[model samples]
Target: MLKKLFLVAAAAALFSGCANVMPTGGGSASDAADVAAAAERLRIAMVDPTRPALSTLVADELSYGHSGGKVDTKESFIADLLDGKSDFVTITITEQTVKVVDARTAIVRHALAADTNDSGKPGKVALKILGVWQKQGGDWKLLARQAVRAS
Candidate 1:
């Protein structure tokens, strides 16, 4: 009887330890909120762009896709913003949703409406954007983004 009791106690302790471990899928509420905040920061940075701010928000291997099928790397994306090649006069994001795929990754979707002055030509755009965010060292960074023209 004593041996059985020891085994039961050992099993209970092991199982309790497992309880503290996060699941491989699904994240906590705070994780979702943090991702949303990171996306908002990126939106703000895009409208009023600064090299340092944009560099911090995007990953080194960022792949940014435009509604017109053009893609930009991390360097090009920042350069265009700073150089007025791709300019955003004002931006508004709506119908935003964030899905935490895991503890370290999230998928965010939103509608982007903006007035732009790209290459000194004024224009407006409405797009549906999908962004992939990855947490690195506690801060979420945009790894990839794709945009399509809104119908």
Candidate 2:
């Protein structure tokens, strides 16, 4: 009788584990749309100097390299913008590509172009930016961003 009881308990535990493994119906088409929208909003915010709220979407510790140089942190990133390090920061996302790599992860590809306006006029600069966004606490936040010069 004890052996039978043990077997029953094991079966119950196994079934319970299987129940938890059932799909939660996450990562649907709507989720993909929402991710794309969020990414575009972030791009808009980054370019619009008046919108401070958009900046929050960016990770506080972002690393970026510009004009064929080394990567830098968020603080330096902001400083660069304010100090006229990047002449014209025009983020043109030719295509907002959202890929749901997992239930809670997405990758957004943004086609971008920038001009260094430190000389008081826009200079020629073009690049493609890829941003990785992670869903955190019901909101999507940018976790990482990288730029590759568009030849």
Candidate 3:
């Protein structure tokens, strides 16, 4: 019985090779476009400061950092955006690049120019932004983001 079990295990291992089990994690053109669309939706949502949109796009474990050396959790980020503390008048992203890392991960980089009315004060910024988007429950959500002042 032991001999038979060993043989069966070996056969199973041989049949279930690494090639059959390893992750094939390349995104198709359509997938890339879809991710881009999600990102666009997120951008529009931020400028609009829509709560549901922000909540939907952002993961619960999000780590959001600003060019001013302040970092915020997902809750705080969304709260500030909704509270008019981070009011955005216009947000324009340029030189955007999206790289799909694996089946569940993607990296996006862009030059962001945002005109804002922060706490009733006008502000404008140019930043080079990097973000990580992860697929969860079949939807891509922002996991982390960092921004640096653009030179």
Candidate 4:
């Protein structure tokens, strides 16, 4: 039947997407571990913001999206941290997972709980974060990140 064929095709597409997230050929476990460590370093840098550290961790084409729908480019992201507009007093990442797509790319997901003092006003946030990282030369740099409110 036509309906049955459509359903089968859709299911196949869905499973193929999942296969990418699940670990495939050519990437090793150590690659995942390295990505995790890179993510941890970025978290620490956000808490104690410094331009050098942030610039090093993020790619030139970084796209950072906040839970509130605002997006920041790499320069704006680092500038906000340096200027106290986006300040992280403390950040805790939990239930983190990293999926290495290849020797040069990875995807990371985690639950984030953070205390903030942005523009000198204190606040707290709970978010689900997805980060895409790419290996540049010898380091993994964050290429993009998106955050959504955790329900």
Candidate 5:
């Protein structure tokens, strides 16, 4: 009888441990919100001139297109931005939509208006931009960005 009781107690303990190990759905909403916030923070960091470190928000392997052409790396892209290579660097996001693709991935679609300091003025150049973000060590980083002129 003593051995049977011990076996039952051990089985209960094993089952309880398994239950604790199972994934719970309760924190998903909070997790999604956190991901979205991280993405937004990256966007804000990119535009702040004082904080050049925010440039790291972009991944080493980023892709982007502008009035001049397409760029396939963070270094080249930043070089162009700082060099005033782009005709206009004005980017105003009118609308933004964010979707969480996974625990560490998100996609943001932004309706933007852009104009170079020289050629076209504000409101003349408009585009839609699709940005992909990935969360790494609690901070969100931009993995890719592509822009298409709005019709």
Candidate 6:
């Protein structure tokens, strides 16, 4: 009974705080829902790169652009997070929208505010982000992202 309860709790945790994206005559529910899941997981994974979810959440060809005009590939992005070059202390995301561009693509937009430590210096940042996510191998993967400073 305890084991069953634990499993149930774990499943709930996995699905919590994420919206189910049912089709609206333009996109697929499963695909949209998976994109939502991916976006959420990416946030968690950024603050804790030890989570294996990072590996699955991002695509091999990801191009992650920062508000400062720097861009990182998937490897560099994960490495920076893991290595403390960009250490996330706290994050709040708002105004998040997922637009399914097609069967295999999605556009995720959000406003993000985060407290971070970069190169051991503490700072705060606010930005509007646009992400391109592609469905590959039956899973949604982040392909490209660009961030613009929110004024």
Pick the lDDT winner.
Answer: 4
Candidate 6 local Cα displacement, residue 121, angstroms: 0.9
Candidate 5: C-alpha RMSD to true structure equals 17.2
Candidate 1 TM-score versus the reference: 0.82
TM-scores of the models, in the order given? 0.82, 0.67, 0.81, 0.83, 0.63, 0.83
Q: List the residue pairs that clash in candidate 3.
A: none
How many backbone clashes does every candidate have?
0, 3, 0, 0, 2, 0
Give the per-residue lDDT digits (tens) of candidate 5, residues 1-151.
6985575356434333322121123324445455445444444333432236446577766777654466557787666555544344544555665566666777777676755553233335678878877777776677888878788
Candidate 6 error regions (>4 Å): 1-26
TM-score of 6: 0.83
lDDT per residue (tens digit) for residues 1-151 in model 1: 6985575456434433322222236776677767776776677678778898898899999999988889999999999999999899998777777778898998888888999999999999999999999999988899999999999
Q: What is the per-residue lDDT of model 3 for residues 5-77, given as tens digits with 9 covering 90 to 100? A: 5754554343223111222267654445445666776776787776887888899999999999999999999
lDDT tens digits, residue span 1-151, model 4? 6985575356434423333233535567767666776776787779877888799899999999998999999999999999999999998777777788889999888899999999999999999999999999999899999999999
Give the CA lDDT, 0 to 100, for residue 60 in model 6: 93
Cα RMSD for candidate 3? 16.1
Looking at candidate 5, what is the lDDT of residue 140? 62
The local distance difference test score of each candidate is: 0.81, 0.60, 0.76, 0.82, 0.57, 0.80
List ranges where model 2 is wrong by over 4 Å: 1-26, 87-89, 119-121
List the RMSD of every prediction in angstroms: 15.4, 17.3, 16.1, 14.4, 17.2, 4.0
The candidate with the higher TM-score, 1 or 5, is 1
Alpha carbon lDDT of residue 58, candidate 3?
A: 90
